[model samples]
Target: MCGGPSAVVQVVHVTSLRINNYGYLERMVPASPSTWMATFTRVVAQAAAGFRRSRRLFHPWGECFAGTITLLVPGTLGIREEYPCLVRLSKGLGFVGAVPDALGLAIRIERPQPWDVLMVSSAGTGVLGRLIITPSALWTRPCYSTLMPYQRADGELMWLHARALGGHTVSVRRNALTEAIKGAPLGFELLSGASNGAVHWVGELTLERTAEPGLSFDPGVNQVEYLRLYPGWLTAIRSSAYLGSRQSRGATLSD
Candidate 1:
């Protein structure tokens, strides 16, 4: 966690993913499903109205909300092959939108950070009035790995890019090496690691926001009015409950 004295960390990722449209299975498909999964999930979550009120709770303006992270992945990665887990998690935590697909993936974290100095500065000078600013960071670093182009019995190249960030890497190949050595276990670990990195970056940004003052709170402004107005403006930041739903879930793991 990164903040002044108190902060909460949340992590999320995909556990199991599957591409339903593909008739036959390919070797390189599983290694980096989360990337594709992330992309699909966001679209689904938005349609479901997830992540509605994430910005206001975690910055210097609000009550300093912390300690929550959420991840989205495919259902094939779960220990129980449970389909409802994703939806249950998303709706319950307000994270919603964990979809599975074949293109690319994404992971997003919501934490309170300071409004951009320029935004606040403009507000102070009356150029911009009553704005809701969401200062959060997103990381979508991709990883790459080599694979031998091989034809399946159907004569098609099963190749995928194995990229990783944070502390995990997915090794995709056009062979059985992935399933033979690690199988489902290692895939779960990799997803978790990526989620951790996403959450860590959010925490870092929240802490950075506290050190910077808004335009109204700048040194030249009256300290008393600046302090008095800060909380009121924060009230406009809005608040939403982080709950689990049918398409998403909280990323907290139990030992």
Candidate 2:
């Protein structure tokens, strides 16, 4: 287990991650599918069709919101401060209406050189649970993970995690995400590292308002100068997906 909310951890990269007390030896992180290039092209086209031709490949139908993410894990995540941000809450697999799907949270911290954090619903606990993507039925008190590792600016590998604060449950229906938080803010506990070893509580991510839509978040392109989304192959796949989606939809970046 980790220390108190105010505790600071000395972060380092090792060959394993322990989720919920289970010591899991780190395994090779897969970045792309088999025969990725040709396969990826076909996947993008299929995704476009799956999303009704004008939506993103995965989180095609999402509502963008304005909020802030307070980063406070210190050494591992760099520093602590509240940053103005834009958040898009969506369902993975491009499913429409009320349905179980991998809940996606894409956050873009506003800065001269902003940082994009893309997380999907996952157990973030057991080996299989952490590796496989799961569609969450509810949004309250749920766990989300990077599903892969990223190298900190200092070259330390770590995974970013988030959890909805207690008593914040909401439905999975279309537009229910922003609706449920009209009066109460949708909050998350930002974390770094894994529980089996040393988990650092980064801070809170609070999404409060439903803003006017039309923002496309491309994590591969809009990231802090040199933030490395590690396991190079995955980055390539992600880059291709994001690029293809935007090109197909004729979308542009927005705040």
Query: Per-residue lDDT for 16-101 in model 2, tens only?
Result: 22112242233333334423342344345544565374455667667788888887644454667788988877777766666688
Candidate 2 residues lying further than 4 Å off, grouped into runs, are 1-43, 50-54, 73-79, 125-128, 194-197, 225-227
Tens-digit lDDT string for candidate 1 (176-248): 2123223322111111112112211111111111111111111111112111222232222211111111123
Clashes of each: 52, 4
Error of 1 at 216 (Å): 38
Lowest summed lDDT window (length 10), candidate 1: 82-91
| Residue 55 CA displacement from its true place in model 2, Å | 2.8
- Runs of candidate 1 with Cα error greater than 4 angstroms are 1-241, 244-255
